[model samples]
Target: MKNIRDSHFKLHTTSPSYPILASTELGILHAKDHGEWHSINAFNLSQKLRDFIKNNTEIFEIDDVFFKSGLYFSDPNKVWIKCNLLTGKELREILCDKYGIYLSRYTKKHILINFHFGVTEECLDTLISALSQIEKNTLSRNFSLNENELSEYFVIPYPPGVPFIFPGQKISKNDINNIKKHQDEKNILIYIKEVI
Candidate 1:
């Protein structure tokens, strides 16, 4: 199974005004809870998250599910995010000055790099290419991780509930079955890969 820890990711919160999203996309809002009309499929969910991070000023409250963060991180209206302890100051500055968004008051304790990359091959490439282009002088690279190490855990998209996993941790058999059941019933897909 994929090392759940290696798959841990933080999402970028963006403003609803980002220009990257088309009027049609902006109008294509899904209820916080995916209904019968649309399901929180893995591909689309990651894409929306990537778009929000690359183009808008958004914030998220931490969510806890799957015994990951426990219930402490779950907040429907709020998103809890973790940044590299070292990059906290700079990230705070970028979000505030560049995006004009305020971070939550909660303290960040880890260096978790939330690579909110999409599950599709194309989106994954886009994310990697963008990461390569970031100039070290212009941006802090504290959150950077070895590219080769990224495949250790696959990014899972479980919406309404934050994506959950940690490297080296085994996915409970029950969770696996539940995920599969959700896929069969709601057309939702949870990405998984063995932890190298």
Candidate 2:
């Protein structure tokens, strides 16, 4: 039984022994000593951020921006904010360039903010202030391609790293519709020959 368990563990594990040992030790320390405290703090901070954003929708100028986890259970470690007017790339660039705060782009229209154990109220305040100062900038115009016209362009969704339409590949009406739907949802970036 012991040998079987050992063989199974080795087969399932990918990391080398030394690093895995160190990581396991750290995980144990965190879980045993600081898990509850960190959980509570992260939960409160995430809630505060959600509340701030919700209350200041005028500042954001977008309704239903934040992605809700559920009514009863929510992940307090990360929050996803939807970008209606600006793409996620644009929003991330603006936040990094202007506010010196970097955010993860979850999709073309969604930016992810992560809450760490060390996150403070002041950090949240700075984020709120930066978000309030953001104004919509004009997006560059791209030639719209219809279902029949999609063969010339390459459409890729960044977050999931999937290509919807590859250049020179024939796309069916359904595939074209899916691409258009994703684009309309601000969930993809379409690349054209001229633009590239």
Candidate 3:
């Protein structure tokens, strides 16, 4: 069932692959190899919408996403919902007019995984000037993670949908290579804690 407690996706058509997400109308095209499914939202709440949520009891969720569930993004205004059945207008009418909800259309976000640059004075100054991120010069404090390891339901935020570190899991390694290997990529940065 959808997080709304009484709503879900129903496929009106079939696909050569994942048959559950094949809908020409919704642009729910396909799935990734790791069972990470993605789709282009056909309906935006900013625009008028149609009643796409059927009056049935069939509940089908595509793993880590739901039609009307809230996701983390540091702000409520950045909350997004992916479509399975309900249209933007239908969602607004049902959830907003009736139940008082404020769900925005899918806001494409660039989520980084297992990486965070320290918020230092220099970093702030660079941000004020809008310069590129500061470099990591300290080698003794670097950390790394196993790209192919994670818990079944580890601490993860949506958008990038990557797993955050959790206790009791061997998802991390003592080597800093995994993180440094991707540092040159867009917005990928890691901070090494300092010792007193």
Full-model lDDT for every candidate: 0.38, 0.66, 0.29
Q: For candidate 2, give the lDDT of residue 166.
A: 76
Listed in order, each prediction's TM-score against the native is 0.24, 0.49, 0.17
Q: Give residue 114's error in model 2 in angstroms.
A: 2.3
Query: Which candidate tops TM-score?
Result: 2
lDDT of 3 by residue, 51-108 (tens): 1112211111112232453663332112233322333355344444544433343222
Give the worst 10-residue stretch by lDDT in candidate 2.
57-66
Clashes of 2: 0
Ordered from best to worst lDDT, the candidate numbers read: 2, 1, 3
Could you arrange the candidates by TM-score from highest to lowest?
2, 1, 3
lDDT of 1 by residue, 20-47 (tens): 4444344555433343323334435444
- Runs with alpha carbons beyond 4 Å of true place in candidate 3: 1-79, 104-196
TM-score of 2: 0.49
Q: List the residue pairs that clash in candidate 2.
A: none
Winner of 1 and 2 under lDDT: 2
